[model samples]
Target: MAKTYKDVKIPEELFFNIKNFIEKYSELGFRSVSEFVNSSARNEMERIEDRKRNE
Candidate 1:
C-alpha cells in the first residue's frame, strides 16, 4: 500500500524563518522546512511520552 500525506498550515513568517535557518545551517541535513518540522514534532512527541511514563 502507498502512504498518504496531509498538509499542516503554519504562519508565513515562521515558514520563512525556518527556511532561512535551514539555508544558513545546511549541515543539519534538513532538506526542506517540512522535514525539519516533522522531525521536531516527532522528537517532541517522544519527549512528552517519556515524561508521562516517568511521572
Candidate 2:
C-alpha cells in the first residue's frame, strides 16, 4: 500500500535545483522527485546503519 505526505515549502533556488535533478533522472525512468529522494535517503540511512552496527 502507498502512503501520503504533507507538502514542504522550500526556497525557489533549492526547489529549482531539485527540479533539475529530477528532470535529469526522469530520462532514466524515475517517476518523480519525491520518489527519487526517498530512495536516496533510504540508501544513505542504510549505509549509516551499517556503519553504526560495525562500530
Candidate 3:
C-alpha cells in the first residue's frame, strides 16, 4: 500500500531524543530518525483510536 504522509514539525528537544534513540539502537531496523518517528506516531494514533472507540 502506498502511504500518504503529512509533514509535521516537533520540538527540537524531542527530535534530538528521537535521533539519539536511532543512534543508540540501530538494529531496530529503522533506517532514519524520520522513519522511527513515523512508525511510533502511527502506533500512537492507533492506540488513541482504539481508546476512543471503547469510550
- Best by lDDT, which number? 1
Candidate 1 regions off by >4 Å?
Answer: none
lDDT of 3: 0.89
Put the candidates in lDDT order, highest first: 1, 3, 2
lDDT of each: 0.98, 0.78, 0.89
Give the 10-residue window scoring lowest on summed lDDT in candidate 1: 1-10
Report the backbone clash tally of model 2: 0
In model 1, how many backbone clashes occur?
0
RMSD of 2: 2.4
| Residue-level error in angstroms, candidate 1, position 18 | 0.7
Which regions in candidate 2 have their CA more than 4 angstroms from the true location?
8-10
Score residue 44 of candidate 2 by CA lDDT. Answer: 100
Rank by TM-score, highest first: 1, 3, 2
Query: Candidates 1 and 3: which is better by TM-score?
Result: 1
Q: Give per-candidate clash totals.
A: 0, 0, 0
lDDT of 1 by residue, 1-55 (tens): 9989999999999999999999999999999999999999999999999999999
